[model samples]
Target: MILQSLVRLYDELSRQGKVAREGWGTAKVSHRLVLDEAGNLTGIVSARKKVLRGKKEKEIPSDMMVPLMVIRTTGVKANFLCDNSGYFLGVDKKGKPERTKECFEAARVLHHQILDGCHGAEAKAILSYFDRWHVDTARECPLIQENLEDILDGSNFLIQVGNRDATEIPEIRKAWDDYFKSAGEEGNEERGQCLITGKKDEPIAILHPKIKGVQGAQSSGANLVSFNKDKISFCSYGYDGEQGKNAPVSKEAANAYGTALNFLLADRTHAKVMGDTTVVYWSEHAKTVCQDCFLGMMGDDSGLTDKELDDILIHMKNGQSADVSGVTVSPDEPFYILGLAPNGARISVRFFLRNTFGTFIKNIAAHEERLKIVHPPWEKDWIPLWSVVKATANPHSKDSASSPLLAGSLLKAVFLDGRYPEALFQNILRRIFSDHDEPAGGGKPEMFKVSYVKAAMIKAYLLKNCGTKWEGKIQMAVNENCNDISYVLGRLFSVLENIQQSANPDINSTIKDRYFNSACATPAAVFPVLWKLANAHLGKLDQPRAVYFKKKLGLLMDKIAMPDRGTPLPHRLTLDEQGAFVLGYYQETQARYAGKKEDK
Candidate 1:
């Protein structure tokens, strides 16, 4: 299914002139080999430009459409028009003059065979240049000496005739295309029915093109569908000692899927990172509106304000078309989201989702709505997924990343409207317990421990997974009418902590720092001790403030139904009950300062 969808994408993108056609591809060229009308080596020029990468500017090579590069591994294959210094200039840091000379000769023979009969000045100049350029004397040329270091660094170069790139000439392009099409058309024994296209007697690709830009994969790139002949585990019974033949993907189908996937991975605007996985998404029918909408929903670089994003999401959820970034996008377009992870020399599929654009919008809207809660005034109205995942990490640990697999799992739950992974809730609880007592470490004190994103996630989880048990009990804010034993205990504990703070304004540590985790787990043992401490704090307050806090505490305590056997507080709370306890404390604390300006 993945390959079939990619093949269709390749066809659509090809018709839109977005991806390279067969026999052609894009290469990053760092220099250009300039030639005169007489085909003499004239000069060398940088083909790189400064572009912003993150906050820093970098000088990177220019991507040019050239003949497809050969899949080389310890081989002397040469590319047409564009290649590294060893193949084009006969000079490199390989420390093998014999091998370098072989590379240059192969390129010379290829150019002569293709462009010799071409009737264009660009073609003639290219042929003349290769004929006159001798490998032995290449280093002696003044132009080569000036740029020798950069060339020896193995950056790719393109051939330029006079003032134009040789590949841009119409006659030369036709010659290369024709030669490419007929170069390898002879009979082959590996021909079979293609698994992707189901076509009979087609040549199977011995090797698929390398996939680049996958995080943590080889910089040279990695293979998605690869089999090693040397490894018996990868060999099928009938296809021993064969690689791509084992899969039986036609050369054309392989090229189409590889090209399409590479195009999506290379695009920065539509590709995003989810933990260790690299995510790439696309629309089925040659439309970028889906990409725009998805990025906007994720709070990424979608060029849309928060209000604008909310408006589009609303329109889509209502089954209406939305004008996103001035492009009208229907809600019913087919959308695909693929997650790729690095696995040794191969890429692993973390997750793949397909749905109508409107369904995705509705799911995301539901997710956002569930995450809604009464947050601090300074927090953004919409919390991005990255922020939610980060809330579970340890701020003091050096490699404090949440589980690498959790991002994909969480995203899958959101997209499918399924139960969220239990790890998300458990990790949040662990972090809350471990980090709740620590000082803010030079940051704002109010931004400590239980963040708005964390609280909202807990509420969202309980409401979704707990079914009708927590339907009306879990709300966006503190519910005074909620009298669940664990919840009321949590609210009472927060009130006691606040009373301690009010009595002693300059106190270094409140009861929360010392007793929060214990109080949440064993409320019966801790709440009675906290009630005795609250009486002391009430005596320290003025008469008016003392009466006010006492009355509030009495009302909260009365809501907790006393048991006939013993006290109202339970001996211990369950994991789900512990989550409600945390939410109760967070929401009640927020309510205390709801209208006041919080000190940062």
Candidate 2:
């Protein structure tokens, strides 16, 4: 199903001239080998330019449309019109003279075979250069000697004639395309029914193109689909050790799907890396609006403005079509999202989800609604997906990464509107317990310990997955009128901490740093001690302020009614109760400082 969707996308992109044709693809060229009429090496001009990557500026190769390249592992394989210096100039930094000599010879033979009878100046100059160049004396050329270091860095090169690129010549393009069409006819290739296209007697691709840009995958690339026939379990009956034949995808279908995936991987607007997973998404009808809107919603850098995205989301919530960046996108258009993760030499499919674009938008909006909480003015109105997952990470850790598996699962749940993974909830709680005393900075007393994102996540999980126990109980802000036992205790803890902070204005540490975790887990034991401290703190306050605080404490304690067991506080709280305690504490703490300016 994934291949079928990608192939279909490739066809759509092809018709729109967004991707390469069947017999061609784009490659990164770092330099152009300038050649004269006599095929003499004249100059080596850089095909790369400096681009800003984060805070650093680095040189990146320019993308050029070139003939389709073959999948080469260690064995020698030469590409036409584009290749590293090893094949083009017969020299490299690897220091293997014999291997470099073989590379040059292979390129020479392949170019000669394709351009043998062509009379075009581009083709003739290319052939003449190959016949005249010598691997042993390549360094003798002043141009090659000057640029040897850069060329040997494995940067690709393209041939440039007087006013045009050699690859752009009509005759050479036709010759190369013709060669590509018939190259599969060579007897060495295995023929079978294509699993992707279902065409019989077609040449199957022994090796599919490499998928790049996936985090932690091979620097060169990794295979999304591959079969190891050496392992008997991977090979079917009668297939023997014919690797690709076991699942037979025709060379054309393989290239098509690969082209589509590579196109998405290369473009930022179509892909995003969350943790170790790289997510690529596309729309069925080839609309840029869908891509832009989706990326904007996921908090990726997109072309849409905040207002534009908000309007689109509002339309989606109303079940109406939206004009995104001046393009009207129907809600019924199919949208596909693919999650790819690195697994050694192969790419693992974390998820492949297909749904109406509107459905996805609605699911995202619903996720936002469920996570609604009273946030500080500094926080954005809508929390991004990355921020939600990042809440699970320990802020003090050097590598701020959550579980990769949990990241993927959390995204899938949000898109499908399913129950969030249990790990997400547990990890958030774990982070809260470990980071109990950490402050959100800016000298705000309410910003300590539990963050807004973590509190929101806990609230969302409990409301949706924890049944009717918490139904109609949780709210975006403090619920002053109502009281659950765990909640009242949590609110009381915040008031006690506030009293301590008020009494000792210069104190850096409060009871939260010492007793928050214990108070949350076993409120009965800690709250009594906190109450004794609160009384001493009250004595330090003025008469009016003391009376006000006492009244406030009495009101909250009155709400915690005693049951038949005659105990105001339970011995210990369960996991769900602990979450509610955190929520109550967060809400009440925010309430204490509501509408107040922070101390400068």
Candidate 3:
């Protein structure tokens, strides 16, 4: 079903001229095989026309549509019509005469294939270039032979004829293109029912193509599906191990879906890398409604101007019903989001979510609302997936990649408005325990406080697991009236820390630096010690300030029951209570700074 939908999208995108043609792929061409109308080799000029110093290489734009990469083997599977100078022009690195000869012969075979299909003026020019060409012992081609040893292995080369690019030459481009579109259909290969299209007598794909640009996968590319005996454990009694026999997918259908998915992955505006998972999304409509706005919501859009982002934020804040660029989103249009993680050569489908565009917006909107805390003004309004995941990663690890499974589960829940992963709760708690409490180090003052993002995440996690009864308690700012013991303790901890700050402004270590984690986890054992410390801090303050804190602490103490003056504090807090503690700490700290400049 996923491949079928992707194939459908491919057809639509091709009809709109949005995706690459069947026989072509994007390439980083660095040299041109300059030729005239008669195929006379012309001077080789550098494709890197502009050079920048203090950088490894110049930044140059790559060509969009070149001949597809060859599926090379020991038998030499050379491209028929369009290829780089190395494959067609016999170019190779220095001191590799055998490789040079092998490639030159491959060029001859490629030239022969092109001639069989095309008989036109430009075709005649191509024949002239290779037919008269002979070996030069001195290695005299100005283009590739000049710097053969230094050329990048995949450095692409293209032909130019009579002041027109080879692609512009009608006969040259069409000849090979026609051959590719018809190549797999000519042979007398056994046919099977296509799993994707259910078409009878269609050839099954021997090997599905590679999916590149997936981080941590093979640089050559990874497979979306595979059935190799050595690599996979599962096998089936099929039509004698024929290609795609167990799970039949026609050659055409496989290519269609593969092509469409690769196009989406290459497009930065359409694809997003979240933690270790790659998320690709699309609308059923030909062109998405406010595509940039849609991308900004799911992925990070660093290109978006602050004003542009603000405009979209305002629209989203209004329930995504506002129009942008005069384009109103049709709420009924279906959208698909596919999350994938790379396994050894195969893709693991993390999540496949299909829903209406309106519903997607709402799910994200709900998540945003949960993250809506009274944060410091300098913090970003747009909290990307990276920041959220990074907070949970261990800071001391060499590779800080988030757990792929956990990240995928969390995102799926956000997209579906379902329950969040339990792992997220545990991971954040681990990070809090690991770093939230420590002595002042390297003579630097402790700035230990609950961050807005972590606090928001805690609220979201609790609401997800515990439901809407927490609605009024978990909010943007402090709730002074609620008397949950954990919440009260958290506020008290912050107040005590503030009193310590007031008493000794230059103190390197505070109670939070020493006792935050213990007080949060086992309040019964720590609060009695903290209350005594608070008394000492209160004594150092002036008369009016000391009186104010004494009364404030007295009232907070009244809320929490003490059978006989600290006789029976709760022994340990549950995870939900811990969340309440974190939120209470954040709200109180934020409350302290809310109206300093505002009142002025």
Candidate 4:
């Protein structure tokens, strides 16, 4: 089903003139080898394209063209009509003698094969150019040396018909197509009902191309499907090592899906690497709005402004969409989302969803609503999931990858409206226990470890369990009207901590530093002791501020009813209650800044 969706997308893309025609593959070209009608290498031209990344413009190899790669593991195997320095001229940076000689030979053989099919005068003249060709004279261009391995050995280079133009000749393309068709015939082709295309008597590719751009996969890439005898019991199924015989996929279907997926993976706007997984999305038809909006939510596209994306989301929240650049998104359009992760050589499907665009937006909007919280002034109106995940990771890295399973589960929950992964709540709690109130400064140790991102994640998790009655009570900021015992206790704890801070502004440690875990876990054990300490701290303050804070604490405490001052607290707070604790502390901190501004 995954491949089918991609195949259908490829077909639609072909119709829309966005992809190459059938039997051709898209390759990112760094430079082109320009050839004359006589097949002489006249000049080397760049195929570099410019694109804007963030606020800066940069150049990347992006002139996509049609070609088939010749992937020989160790030896030279030239492309049908295009290749990089390694295959065309054997220009290794280290100048390896054996590889250089071998690649030249491969090029010689490939051109001879092309010469054999040519009957015209141009073809014969091309053969003459090859006769006088010298591999020793071929020099590597400076562009090929930029990140040597990735450019010369890694990227695909192309062949153009002219010295400077990337345009192709009709006759050459037709001749190449004829040769390509004859070469694709695999002997002993499988004869069975194909699973994907449902055709019979068609060839099936046992080894498909390496799937690229997946995070943590093999550097060379990984396979989507394969079963070895050592790994699985049903390897051969009574056939002599005939791979992929059981789960039949026709060669046509295989190529179509592979090509389409590669197109998506190579495009940054369509693919997002979130920790262990790479997610790719597309609509079945020409719905640019759907693709852009979906990517916009995940913070993958750099072209759209934040407010523009946010406006689209807001309109979506209302079950309506505004026109965007002459194209308006409709909720009824079909959409597909696929998440893939690496498991050794084989690929793992984290999740796949097939639904209308409306359903996708609805589920996502609901999740955003759940995560709503008053953020710092510097924070963006919309938060990416990666930011939430990073708060749970070690603090040194600006871009820490979340756990693979956790990232997948969080995305699934966002798009499915299902229960969140169990690890998210537990991980947040673990961070809370180990962290302190460490405000950060230039290369200095933090004085407040509680971050807005982490607090927002805590709020989101708790709000998932918040019942309808607590709507107004559980809000973006401090909610004084809330009557929930856990929430009220959390708020009370915040006030007490603040009084300690007010009394000793320069103190290295406060009640929070010594008693935060205990305060949230077993409030009964910590609250009574903290209240006595608060009186001492308040007495150190001026008489006017002392009376004002005392009255505020007394009113908040009045809302908390207990049989007696010595009543025992619950042994430990549940996950939902833990969220309340975090939110109350976060809100209290924000209120402090607000009060200071008012005083000024």
Q: Write the per-residue lDDT of candidate 2 for residues 229-344, one digit (tens) a residue.
A: 56578687677677787788998999999989999999866788877778999998779889888988776678888898889888887778987656888888899999999999
| Number of backbone-clashing residue pairs for each candidate, in the order shown | 0, 0, 0, 9
- Against the hidden reference, what TM-scores do the models get? 0.77, 0.76, 0.73, 0.75
User: Which model scores highest in TM-score?
Assistant: 1
- Higher-ranked by lDDT: 1 or 4: 1
Model 3 C-alpha lDDT per residue in residues 78-128, reported as the tens digit of each score: 664446555655655555667766776777767668665666666677677
User: What's the residue-level lDDT of 196 in candidate 3?
Assistant: 87
* Global Cα lDDT for candidate 1: 0.86
RMSD of each: 6.9, 7.6, 7.1, 8.0
Residue 305 CA displacement from its true place in model 1, Å:
2.7
Off by over 4 Å in 3: 24-179, 186-188, 230-233, 237-243, 286-291, 302-323, 326-328, 437-449, 562-568, 595-600
Which lDDT tens digits does candidate 1 get at residues 1-600? 889889999999987879987898889999999998888888789999899999999999988788989999988999999999998888998789999999999999999899888887778888888888889998998888887887787478999998999878889889987888678656654889999999998878888888998877888889988887654777886888788887889888988999999999888888887677788888898688778778878756677777777787888878998886677788898888888888998999999999988898788878888888998778876777777777778867787676889988998998888998999999999988987555545764545667788889999999888857788998998999898888887788888988999999999988988889999899988888898999999999999989988898989978888678877778899988999999999998898887345443
Prediction 2 global C-alpha lDDT: 0.87
lDDT of 4 by residue, 1-600 (tens): 888788888788877768775556677777776568776766656677889999999878875656555557866577655666665655666558677777767776776785577675455544555466655654444533444455454466566654433225455556666677658876666656668877777676676656877777887778886644533565655644667775777766777777778788888777887668788888888577777888777655556667767777777767786677778777677889899999988789999998878788778777777777776677675677777666666565576566668888888888888867778877877778787776668886553456777777777776674555345667888887876667777777778878888899898887777888888888777888988999899989999889988988988778777666557456677777767877787787787777787899
Over 4 Å off in model 4, which ranges?
Answer: 25-179, 230-240, 286-289, 299-301, 318-321, 396-401, 441-447, 466-470, 564-571
Best by lDDT: 2
The TM-score of predicted model 4 comes to 0.75
Considering summed lDDT, which 10 consecutive residues are worst modelled in model 1?
437-446
Ranking by TM-score: 1, 2, 4, 3
In model 2, where do residues sit more than 4 Å from their true spots?
25-179, 439-448, 564-566, 598-600
Best of the two (3, 4) by TM-score: 4
Which candidate, 3 or 4, would have the higher lDDT against the true structure? 3
